[model samples]
Target: MDYAKTERADALAAGYVAGTLRGPARRRFEALLPGHPALRAAVRDWQDRLMPLTASLPPVAPPPHVWAAVERQLWPTVAAAAPSPWWQRLAPWRALSGLALVAVVGLSVLLATPPPAQAPVVVVLQSTGKDPAVAGSLVASFSGDGRAVVARPITPVAVTTDRALELWWAPLEGKPTSLGLIRADGVTVLSRGRLPGGLRGSGIDHMAVSVEPPGGSPTGQPTGPVVFYGKLQL
Candidate 1:
C-alpha cells in the first residue's frame, strides 16, 4: 500500500515487470496488487515502459543443432549410436548409384537448415568529418544480454591533452543524454544505467561522440560539435 514511498516496492515492481521475480516473490507481488492500488499502478508503469522491448522481438525457433544437443545430453549413448540416417549407412547398397543420390539429398537437408540466431547488435560509428583529411571511427557492441554496451575505436582518434571524448545517447525526441567520457583509442564500457532504455526496446536514435573538456561536459549536455555518430542495429 505504501509502494510509492519505498525503494523495496519499486524494485519488486521492476523485477515483476522484467519477469525476473519468480516463485514466492512473484506470488506475493500478485497477491498484494489487488489490495494496494499504488503497487498495482507501479507494476503497470513498469510494464508500459518495458513491454515494447520484449514485445518487439520476433519469436525465434531453436536451430536443428539445438535439438541434437538436447538429445545428446538426455541420451548420449543412443544419440551417438543413432543410425547414420540410412544415407550414411548406404555402403551396403554400393551397387546402386541411386544410394549416392540419396546420401546427397540427406546431406543437403542437414546442411540447408538455417543457421542459429544472430548475435547481439553492434553499431559502427563513422567520423562525421566532412573533409577527407579527418579519419576516425568506433565500434559499439552490446553485451549478449543487452545489459551493457562497449565502444572501441576502430581508427585512432586524437584529442588534446586538456580535452576528453564523450559519448551521448541521442534519443529520437529529446536532448541527448551523456553516457560518459570515452577513450580515444581504447575500449570504453558504458554502464547499464547510462544506456538508453529505448535501445533495448524500439531502438535508440543514435550515439554520438563529442570533444569536451577533461572529466566531461560541464553542463551535463554536449558543448562541442558531434564528431561521430551511429545508430544501433537491434
Candidate 2:
C-alpha cells in the first residue's frame, strides 16, 4: 500500500500503537515499519505521548457486554455454545463470574510479562573458524504474537564505527530480506509483521548476519561476507 509515503501512515501508526489495529491489518502495518524510520519514530512518539494518559486512567470494572466480548476472544468455543446475547439470564453470567476471575488473572499475567522472550522460538547463530561457544554467539527469538524478532548477543562481536552488523532471513526459496541492524552487546528488537512466508512455517532455511557500511547495506542486498549463520527453528 506504500503506507510509508501516505498521510495514512500517521493514522495507521497511531492505531497500531494504541492496540486498536488487529488481525491482518495490524500485521500488515508492522511489516511496513522496517523500511520507514519516520513511521517508526512517529509510533514511538505516540507511544510516549499515550502511555501516561493510559497509566493515569482509573481502573474501572468492565460492563457485562465487555466480558462477553472478551470471552469470545479468549474462548470462541465457549462463546459459540449459547449463540445468544450474554445478557440473557440463561446465558449464566453468574456461573461465568468465576471463569471471569480466571480470565482476569490470566490476562494480568499476560500483560505483566514481556511477550517475545517467553519460550520464544530460537535460532542460535554461530561464527565460523573460532569456537562457536566463544564470543560472537547470538540468540534470535520471536515475540509471542510473531510480530517482532529479538536478537541478543551471548558474547562480544566487534564492529567499527564505519560498519554495522545487519541481520537477514533467507527463506526456503527466495532472496534474503533484511530484518534490521543490531547492536553487539544489548538486545535488539525488530518489530515486524508476520515473517515472510519462506521464513515462517517450515519455509525458513537459515538466518545470517553480515558486516555492512554504517546504517546497513545500501543496495538492499548484503555487500559484505556473512559473519554468522544459523539454521532457524521454531
TM-scores for candidates 1 onward, in order: 0.48, 0.46
Tens digit of per-residue lDDT, candidate 1, span 17-110: 6555778989988988898777877787656654543354456888699999999999999998987765556666663677768689989987
Question: What's the CA error at residue 137 for candidate 2, in Å?
Answer: 1.2
Report the CA-based lDDT of candidate 2 relative to the real structure.
0.69
- Model 2, total clashes: 0
Cα lDDT of model 2 by residue, 1-234, tens digit: 665653456556656765656799988878878988878976886566445433533455666889989998999998888666444544477758866887999899889965432333456576753323223556676544445788877557766677788888877788888889988878898867637532354366788888788879999998987888876545
Runs with alpha carbons beyond 4 Å of true place in candidate 1: 1-118, 130-134, 196-198
Model 1's TM-score against the true structure = 0.48
Worst 10 residues of 1 by lDDT: 49-58
Per-residue error (Å), model 1, residue 92: 44
Runs in model 2 deviating more than 4 A are 1-118, 129-135, 197-202
